[model samples]
Target: MFWFLLIAMVVVIAAVTLAVVGGGESDVLPEAAPQHLTDPLPLTRPVARADIEELRLPVAARGYRMGDVDDVLGRLGAELAERDARIAHLEAALAGAQATAADRPGAPGMFDEPPADRPGDLPDGSGERGEDR
Candidate 1:
């Protein structure tokens, strides 16, 4: 029984070795991502918000010129945040306007123009005092 087990183990090892050796050249091996792939900035590519946020610059003898990179990243982050806030504000305004229009009794439809006759008209084309101009 011991001899049989030893023979089986040897056969398994031989099979594994043969399979690995028979596999085609290094080309068949899984290729690793290039070193630069992890860096946020790649030459000739446009930088994005996430790329700026997650950037990892290489350091040399004097180390990285971090002040410049930090300033740029901070400015970019702030700008991106401000733009997001503006988008949210606009979206909220749009939603509120839509809701107000929907609640009106006679809201104007697409291509419908407000009455130019009214001095100060509401969105529903009602005059300021709900009377005809």
Candidate 2:
């Protein structure tokens, strides 16, 4: 009756506990180390848009390591500055070349005068309409 059911339940609980806790034998699962970021940014080549998008910073005890964030920011800043300087230099060189070309005798300029007569027009000043006209 009730006593028989209670005894059966107790035996089942005790068996499960022993099986899980395992009388002090070595467990099947061994201790594992936490995952960490090994190689974040590429050293040989420049960082591309894809690299930035795919970057996953390693998490620290608090949130993220500050050193990694600072390093990435510094590198991106340096690259932008260098690109800006190069752009300015190229723009100056282009302006100088355009000026020299314009000063030459037969170089076409943007401010050239328009022709007095228009094409497809007759002496009467009427333009070509179509075959019907």
Candidate 3:
């Protein structure tokens, strides 16, 4: 029985080795030839001196200037005050113009009487008399 088993094992090993060695095969094809290609042309231009000088000009010459932080704040405050005064003056002028219009003789519906329930008893219906209704 030992001799029979040993012979079978040797036969199996030999068959496996032959199968592995004979299974490999190589396939080869021809290599492709190279083709010529052209390079792209450059499309850039140099800047002129005048262009550089224009870019270097100061901002102040273009009607803008930088001030110190405090100076800018002060100027802003002054401008706001001026605007407030102008607004007040305009409001006063508007009130005066309204008064003058109300006083005009022939303005359309300008002299119309006030309703009975109005707050004041001013004789001219102008509320200037300051009397309680």
Candidate 4:
């Protein structure tokens, strides 16, 4: 049985070697003379100036008037004033919060207390008390 398998493997390898060496099938195209081709129609035409000048423009009228530069500048100044007021309000709020935090007890020295030895050091009775009894 082993010898039969070895012979079958040798036959398969020989067939594969023959197929590779023989360059299995032809994929090359036959040689032919190249042909020249030409375009069938004209690609472009010249535009008439009268046709262009007589064309009616279809633009919609703007709702807001953009007439004077000073008017635009005035609107921008009003918007900036509103933004400045908002910034001032936020700064006041931040200052109030900082003041309140500073006035609160244990604000600066929050971590000044010594670290507890175990989790149950503070008196809520979960069995890690230091006193013997």
Q: Cα lDDT of all candidates, in order? A: 0.67, 0.79, 0.56, 0.57
What C-alpha lDDT, on a 0 to 100 scale, does residue 74 get in candidate 4?
Answer: 62
User: In model 1, where do residues sit more than 4 Å from their true spots?
Assistant: 1-63, 109-133
Q: Assess the local accuracy of residue 91 in candidate 1 as a C-alpha lDDT between 0 and 100.
A: 90
Q: Which ten residues in a row have the lowest lDDT in candidate 2?
A: 123-132
**Could you tell which candidate, 1 or 4, scores higher by TM-score?**
1
* TM values, all candidates: 0.36, 0.55, 0.31, 0.31
Show the colliding residue pairs in model 3: none
> In candidate 3, where is summed lDDT lowest over 10 consecutive residues?
34-43
Clashes of each: 0, 0, 0, 0
Q: Write the per-residue lDDT of candidate 2 for residues 26-96, one digit (tens) a residue.
A: 66577566546666777788788898898888787788878888888888888789889999999998888
**Candidate 2: residue 9 Cα off by (Å):** 27
Two-way TM-score contest, 1 vs 2, winner: 2
TM-score of candidate 1 to 2 decimals: 0.36
lDDT of 3 at 33: 52
User: Candidate 2 at 99: error in angstroms?
Assistant: 1.4
Per-residue accuracy of model 1 over 1-133 as CA lDDT, tens digit each: 9999999999999999988788678648676643322454534644576766687765544766575567657766776787899999999988888777777778674344666765444676544654434
Top TM-score: which candidate number?
A: 2
| Alpha-carbon deviation at 81 in model 4, angstroms | 0.4
